[model samples]
Target chain A: MASKLDLDPRVVRSARRLAAKAGQPVVDLARSHTTVSVERAVLRLAGVQGADQDGIPWVNRLVDAVRADVGLGHGVAVPVFHAMRSTGVDDITVLAQKAAAGAVRFDVPSSRSEVAAVKRAAKRATGGGLKIVDRRRAERERLVKRLGDPKQRPWIYLIVATGDIYEDIPQAQAAARAGADVIAVIRSTGQSLLDYVPEGATREGFAGTYATQENFRLMRAALDETSRELGRYVRLTNYASGLCMPEIAALAGMERLDMMLNDSMYGILFRDINPIRTFVDQRFSRQVHARAGIIINTGEDNYLTTADAVEAAHTVTVSQLLNEFFAHEAGLEDWQLGLGHAFEINPELPESFRLELAHALLARELFPDAPLKWMPPTKHMTGDVFRGNLLDGFFNLVGALTGQGILLVGMMTEAVVTPWLSDRDIALQNVRYVLTGAGNLHEDFAPAPGGFIQQRADEVLGEAVDLLAKIVDDSLLTAIAEGTFGIMKRPADRGKGLDGVARHDDDYYNPVTEALEA
Target chain B: MSIVRPYGDTTGDGMVQLSFTLPIPHDKRAEGAAVQLANKMGMDPALLVHARPMGDGFTFFVVYGKVSHLVDTEKVQVVERDYPLLSAKEVNATIKRRLRRRLNVVGACIGTDAHTVGIDAILNLKGIAGEKGLEYYSELSVTNMGAQVSVPDLVETARERKADAVLVSQVVTQRDAHLQNTRAMSAAFREALPAGKRPLLIVGGPRFDELMAGELGVDRIFSRGTTPREVASYLVHALVGSSS
Candidate 1:
């Protein structure tokens, strides 16, 4: 398809170039430092399992012990593995248990051969983890081939978060049967602030289910069963973000999750996670996603929720470009990029639907091969469900006309209440009607050469170029401090996880990072 | 003396529609169960208009029924606007003349509730609907603390700012979090400051019951669709005008 927006190719190129320039320093910074979560992720990859009786993860305990005694600058892998080899406790979990019990001590092995032996052991254990990830990826491919993929352009993405994994399973299966192609289990509120991932199947969570390994396994099995019954593969998604980004990514890979909310700046801007910590953790997490064949969904849609969608349009575009740069740098392919945009323009605005169409089309045209995740109207959802449903209809129509890859089914009860099962049924019916009615609309839809849609898209792209240039000049960190994106002033140095980040020493070794980079 | 009954198609018909979900599949028994439940709740001769299976072992039903219950207008009680609704100028002037200084107000969304839209609407310059927020009032200095603030931090901020009023908004009522957080906040404020020195604790949310203000240990409760001007007027009425 030709560029209906007729955006200046020169401006587009400059925006991409400036985004790359803005992200390069952050990427370099991420490469040189490691957070406590990154090291714990290594321990998790090396088969360290189970929390103590207090519900604290053994990985957190082992990493804390190592950081307390030997410091994390040398990485947790060397000291923990060295203790394993010397103590003859071959199992990392047992070693962690002993360390938590004060029976085992983490000391940096001084001798060269001892260090080399520990490195080899760490490499072997993580290599086992990699094998599992590779098998899961292959298994997903097989299932998609056998059961068949969704024969639709915009796969209906639905959310099922009942705070219990058991409850979520049935709801997710029901959604899959209701024509939803992807199911996302929203993590419990404030899970991002937790430094350690929870264990086992949790029964209680606020607003959403806990993203635990067991929960992941349970949901994956249920979705697989539903896929075979429906003859169309159902994909699973979860947040591989927050303080434990890398650890969650590693777990998602092991559990065969197909999509992850893995934005680079989302944690920094929204969650107030330290920029350095988020950057370092996101880089490693993206590498895990790349290896696991997991599509990464960036959180540019959130900026519109905090700031006005019309005014902050360029911020979303800039963040999308920067996310693209970072994901590509982390070895994620174009197809794995689920860059986000939302239909959050005030419905009362004149020509709101046309504006939404222009924005959605702009995102679609900019990243032609990427499966853009188009969000629905959230900021303007009044308690009036009648009007909310109509807004969602317009959202669905715009999605169909713009060729969005992933459309999150919007509930009319979004702001009114937690949606009932009947609400979801009605929402799915709305989506089905619009999608089937306008299935072939995109093929014939074309904006006039210099029409409103065309001019608006071009204007957003030009503004995005200017914003990216400013970000590059001030450095991304300084721009963030000045409230450039989301109108959130998150200083680079102040946030939750700055204490967990450490500069790598000369002898620092993480076999997983080494393997991923290689 | 006036009495009222729910009206659907005709006046005084006592006809009403109720929708609910039961833990049973969509079947004749499920419809019968819904009717039975409605009948137990004072609805007689209930009609099961619609039934559908929500998921496995769950059914949703819409029932139309007639109830004998009537509301007596004279005996009915509600939280009326007892205070005068002042304009922005009246509020600022009242604060200036009575308090002899600008009133300090601190607002936040305490606990793990990250939703700030409600608080922002009440505190930010660009308020919800047409009325401007408290920040637009010249004699009311507003400090909006954004979201996810802990109760202890809120108390300390209130103390530091010497706030005359602390307005807290809770949007996420999941698992009754808004109620729990409000109780915790009110209790913390009570514990930290003497009754006379304490700031007026006001909680607002869509789900909060306006009549539960005293039970929840707050000075007042603002339900949904509360304009910022109403809040400003209430502050003046409680702190400046009433005290004066």
Candidate 2:
């Protein structure tokens, strides 16, 4: 099998665990967290608070390895040496000796030095008792227990971002009543990078909307009521990838959010976030997701939004597998995987519709049982709202014919503006038509079962394996600079917002950051 | 939009690349303080933006500001399209020829992309083209997909079949997530594709420039620089020509 880059050992480890439970096909990880306050308080009590990686660059490397180790074989040492803060196991020599003896669980090489160098770096991060398995093992057990399947008949999903969490609740409730299976309160335009997660529900936001716990709790409770009233489960989602990616993941887990939009490259390609920082946050966030049993969806689909959807199709596939690899390392199961793709290729193209089918079908087969989140098209819309409506109907047909597990609703008012109720009804009517008419389409969807489709999957998998080999050889950090992932070049310390970075001092603060690193 | 959670309730993980040009000479003092202030607040120091001195003590910067956040990326609820391309004339013709009806369109910015110029170009529709506006179409129907329609309400109104199109105008590019609106509409089409068959997918805005337009997967991409003629021509050609 060909791979894109070195599979983060942590991701591999996580994938193994998820794969083990997936044999049952119905294990649910999207459970709710009832006491966010208590959990957060506990995290604070555990001395884990803000950003603690002062001077310690590449925290993502350790997080990635830890995430990969979740369900994989025996875990490896992720040396976290803090030359600044002296813990009981002060220097790298002591830490390396511990890691060698299986006392320390991590390893980090200082300035790309030798074995002793790794040891020296590892020592900087220990001293604290946070790395011990006994400290948090019981909690992990409970979080794992919350995992179970809903066995739902395709629950409907919808978005509810009004900038204000209070406003989002009413809308979310309405959507739940209207047959939405999942409700996503869109995050503020650039919420991903704010190092400090917004504390609570808010109003008056620009662009999209912000994602808040009050919003999540209010909406979750409302949906729960609706679920009982309607007899089903309603899940909530938010984003967990930015400057404080790990911190946000901790929040989501404590808050009991069912789904999170956690992608590695979203920050790199779209936000121009530092790649190393993004990956680090992703790793720790995945660990939190694993502990909280949250399902994560990647942003490979966004690449299509910028790059040509058709030409960039393979990148989507590559990203999916890489995401999968990452998720595995994070201890996430395939079912928790919500890899995204879209019906965005120009509908006018002769092969556009076929390509859509090929892509959707390929994703379904490649990662069967993953409630694949099928995205609606957004590239070619015109402000002529009516025409937008009609285009949505066509898009809906594509969703139905393809057997997409999670199909986001399409609105006609797209390019021009936000839709009103009247617009939604027409949109819903279109969806109803497709669902009722083509419900059996999947039964008829037999692309030779194992011929072209399987070959494609196999071929992609082979490519992924090959890519992984190259990454392992070249190193993951090196591959990122080469623009091998999203084909978007991202320098380690350059881009749209490098000035936002703050270097850690000898007295770097943030206890939560301290505990997690420890 | 209402706020229920208390202020600062979240840890504020979302970051913004706030860019403003100040007339300060190039200096490291202000730059250092700006980064320091953001860090003093608990935001991760990883994504700080570029803060450079413009002149005489003022400066410009693309700061990565963090705001606590929660969102699920996997579960999206939207109604939109893979692609819908049309010109003012083509859009008009699409309504007239396909459904043989007229369209009503109203457009404006809801929140703050603050780019009404985009809305004016497509909605004024005196026609950058030689043809009349989509409103003048004999067979087609149009309605603006008004900016900032509350998500819930958008769902409610988009369901109305009277309107054939919902034109939306947004110029906010502070972050790329603005595309979520288009995604919302495409999500609503699950039923339309098989039986009802919707009006048509069309979008335009300054940010929806030719290149950005394709990335958003819009049907008809009309950017700020587009002329009425070009916009109309593309819409009519795309919708009318392609469907027929």
Candidate 3:
């Protein structure tokens, strides 16, 4: 069955060649060789290659490959350097097109072969890949450390992505100071899809701004600076989705960014990105996130923009579970998961707040350790700027009540236009009041057990299970073409970048493969 | 027909549609000014609801209380009737048999609008219509000029190459970019060919469609939600079936 993303024929042909060399179907080889399930098997079949091996240590092996992919020059090709076994594919002309015009990379693996015998513990060395990391315990530790528990939640999460590193740095610092736990620099809205990462800082952008390495570095430094000042680590985030998701993840990891928006399905849904490509890229990017200690932010909030947030509430839950599954496969700890949702459906809905509480609580329960990114509403604003502000106030109230880990402040002028600094101040005031007035709200909070709130949460889970079951039975790839998620119906045989994809023959030319293998 | 139970009057109540994308953490006072600007545009302040901020600084809105200002939506007929639509199979078959040759379709992002996103949505190998792009059809040759092609140069080349259809995508309409290029495109179109033999002109943008295309002499317009299938269907129906 074809994927929601049409598999590039070049990727198909490369997979055929790779399989021929290994004497097996790439899908079968990946299924047998790796722990990822069949859902992502289609991605492996699309010629998305991985790194040589994890457990191998070579910090300098990382390069600035992502820069050149986005029209900058050749640096370390961090994603490529980390490419353990498949580093050779980076140079393979056939795979270059699928490489996202040198813009993207598929899943690459890392190795922790260097953590020598522990002198302190004496009996054993615990850090040799998943052999040492207790996934379940680590996830729980993360959850307790940050969010407390499903019953008790924490503060709001917001984003700051101005194109200029100079601009983003100060803005991120301000957000962190203003009580934002999470700061996401919206990568110049569509930079993820670009094959290469821009070299340095950029000033202008179409919507939000660009997410260059320099910008990432500048913002990460600023956040780190604030984290020290605030006495708590304020996490920084940017998109690692799009064509170069894996490569960006590598960069984020190198730069010590706290989190990255690395969803498997978001690319296909909003960007018309092929499902196979997205999955493959996501897997690769997640692997990088695993190595970098970066939390991965999924785009369930985006699903609200296209589909109805109220109606598709379950989708957020479902995506969280799937993201949980993918994050696990990529070896990401629950602590490193920032699953997303939003409060953007019309506030006029009678039970709007109740629905939001249900959704937020469900995410908290489902992932438990993930720092869930709660979004602000904007879908149905008709330009009544003042009412828009009041609506945002209600959004803030929901964040406080539901105990959301990350609360994105809603700007009242959502439907009207871009906000000025004055708007930011008022928004900050709204957030400050809610945080101050309701600082202890979570302490006294108690949703009636097994009541409408809990029941609704359960209902969304059921819907999610049904959707996943169908995905399992019909193939997630086919479901994408069928438009099971977004209203779009992109066929498996079509989409942009079809011509840009070139298949890998036998001898692809990446050097890190041997270096990692060594 | 009047509003039942009398809500605040919204008629003529002329309104200005003011929308701009700003940075996050919206300011109510700044938003008020945006609404005030609408009032300046002759729109009553009471008739607007979307003077709010768009997240990440790119807000979208529509002000529709009552335009004591009217623009004749009825007289606002688009160039939709200029061509008929064919199915994917029909589209492929028509070019092969009737044109007696493969029709070449060239697309580009004219002027300083470096955004190739919208045009790439149409003419690339992943054609918009359930099928692939014009490249998929054996009967049509396609050359996508990607981004940053000047309007005059684009016209010179399309004419030199004798394109069957010229697909123009206008993005980055910030600060009347669209208006400037719209005029440039017309001038180039006028310069590129004698009015009679110009290739079927198709204009698409976030806000433009064949209606604007007809108003500007473009053969057709495919608006934002326009599908690749619909575009393919129209192209085939027009080229194979009729011209006038």
Winning candidate number (TM-score) = 1
Tens digits of per-residue lDDT for model 2, A235-305: 77888876666656765665667788898667776565765556545655775676566778788777765
lDDT of 3 at A153: 44
Model 3: lDDT to the true structure:
0.57
True contacts kept of 3: 0.04
| Full ranking by lDDT | 1, 3, 2
Could you give candidate 1's per-residue lDDT for residues A185-256 as a string of tens digits?
999887888899999999888888889999999999999999999999999999999999999999999999
Residue-level lDDT of model 3, residues A1-518, one tens digit each, is: 11211223453343223323322222222222211111111122122223323311111112223323321111122233333224444332233333433444533223333111111111111121122223422542464365432232445456564456677777777666666767777665446555545555678765466765577667767775677677666767787876666556656655666667787677766666655555555665676577557767777887776556766776676666667667776678877787888876666678888887777766666655677777887665545677877877877877776656766777775533355544665687788787678877765776666678767776776676666666665665666788666444555456543322223222222221112122
Q: How many clashes would you count in candidate 3?
A: 73
Which DockQ-derived CAPRI band holds candidate 1? medium
**Candidate 2 ranges with C-alpha deviation above 4 Å:** A1-153, A384-387, A448-479, A482-487, A496-518, B1-170, B173-244
DockQ each: 0.51, 0.05, 0.08
Positional deviation of A394 in candidate 3, in angstroms?
1.9
